[model samples]
Target: MTDAFYDSHCRVQAEKMNDLAVSDPKQLVALSEQRYEAQIRNVCSYICNNMERSHIVLLAGPSASGKTTTAHKFRKMLKEEFYVNSYVVSLDDFYIDQCRLPTLPDGSKDLETVYALDIDCIHQCFDQLTNTRRASLPTFDFHTASRSIITNDITLGDHEILIVEGIHALNPLITEGLDASKFFRLFISVKGEYSLNNEVVLTHEDLRFIRRCVRDYYHRDSSLERTTGMWASVRAGEKKYISPYKCYANLTIDSLILYEPCIFHHFLCPLIEQMDPKCDIYPRFERLYHILQYFAEFDRHYVSEDSLLREFID
Candidate 1:
């Protein structure tokens, strides 16, 4: 049986828990943080301890689900016992340039689909990494509008680990004949644990939508309207390309927390305020404003500017 905490109708029970302790909201926040951290450590330990040989641990996740951040944390833990050398291979870096990629039914660029990546090149990189002692990785330059495979070689001795985190890492085409024992798989998703006044539950996709909106505005030089507009297509691509392969993973990490939205609100609310009142996003702005009202205020005074959350909020 599914834990009551994770049930599909968990929102109603969560509300009951909220009402039962309405006088001590801090207790819920603290307990949620503890659960979140424990989940991170548990996932990391499972991967590091369960592997029997040198294998490419495939960490696949939807966008802004803290895949990159969690990879960093997991590497830190692995280093305590093994001479681990980790490299983050972003699928975004492997994207076929906009000009060369496939066109949508409307003639616009299909930026979110697997067709945007050079799958053959990706297969080559994995083959090289697994077969040879030394390999050079490719780096994609989004700003310059080009890609050049890095020719410098990296040699990994024993007691080393290679972690590849991306949208398609679990896709069979990426690593076809590799032994199952040689490759451990993980699927990560930003399944939000927050709710609307402990009533209307927030879905995992909702958290990702907010994370993408914050990330696109800050890093990709995209506007809230543009990110919100493209989200449906991005989500469709995930359903088609990413979700089907999730069953293949050995582990699934729920990168959700009750506190993150509260933390996110601190940074994202002000940016939403800057949107033009006359724009189409005004209605969304109202919804975002309503959400902000529910969270107890977070003082971002402690949040580091270099933090991954900064990638979204800044």
Candidate 2:
């Protein structure tokens, strides 16, 4: 279940728990990492036990919810421990061309909707993989916002599974008419909120925003303005396309790392200090910066190489 505390009880809980700044950061960091890995191991064990019934794992999450990292790690653990060959199939690669996409009310491309994907192509891929244990997949280029002609062909041997990761992974359209018994679905996100002085201080939404800001700046060449400007739409898309289907998931994973707020705070504080305050999104960052100050910073070097935090920070 998603750990949440509100009111006076929540504040007392956060105050008692948020003591890493005064404690040994190194020891606490190791313990925190272990806790997260423990959850992954348990999930893998469950999936392996049910291998006879399910070969396809659908992983769905909202923006900046660490879906990509969890999907890869889940596949990695399955192979390393159980010797189950699992392949991660990114639904992002199946997106149709941007020009042909359906538009929203403001004339902007509705890229978040499941309709943006080629439904027929997905069915074809599933058929091929289930029957022949091989499928040639299309590659979508984000820079061009179009599907590349180049194909990625993948083959699965006996005892292998395909893990599909995307916002629409849990949508019924993706699995309609298919045998529901053949799939295991997971929904992951940061579901916990931080409280201070009996009031909510930091929320999962704020945490995700900070993550996207840092990720886009470092990897996507996007400015703070660009990411913040689109924050509303990203959230709206999550509620409309992602959250409603969360109930369809067989399991939900709380992707929150207790020490992650500090890691993000350390990097994001310095980075946002350089942005233009006059920008519309500056106020949001200001609010985040305030809430972040209550938490202690964690050293990035101590973060393990396989840490999911590596997906965004490094």
Highest lDDT scorer: 2
lDDT of each: 0.68, 0.82
The digit string of per-residue lDDT tens for model 2 on 1-314 reads: 11322344432235544564347667656766776788889889888889877778899999989999999999899989888988888999989999989999999998888999998898788777766778998999988999998998888776888899999999988877667777899999988777777677878788888888999988888888889888888888888999999999888897777777878888889876886899777788888887778887767887779888888898
- Per-residue lDDT, model 1, residue 130, is 66
TM-score of each: 0.82, 0.92
Tens digits of lDDT, candidate 1, 192-255 = 4554544665556667778887778778898888988887888888888899999999888877
Clashes of 2: 0
Clashes of 1: 0
Worst 10 residues of 1 by lDDT: 12-21
TM-score (C-alpha, index-matched) for candidate 1: 0.82
Overall local distance difference test of candidate 1: 0.68
In angstroms, the error of model 1 at 204 is 2.2
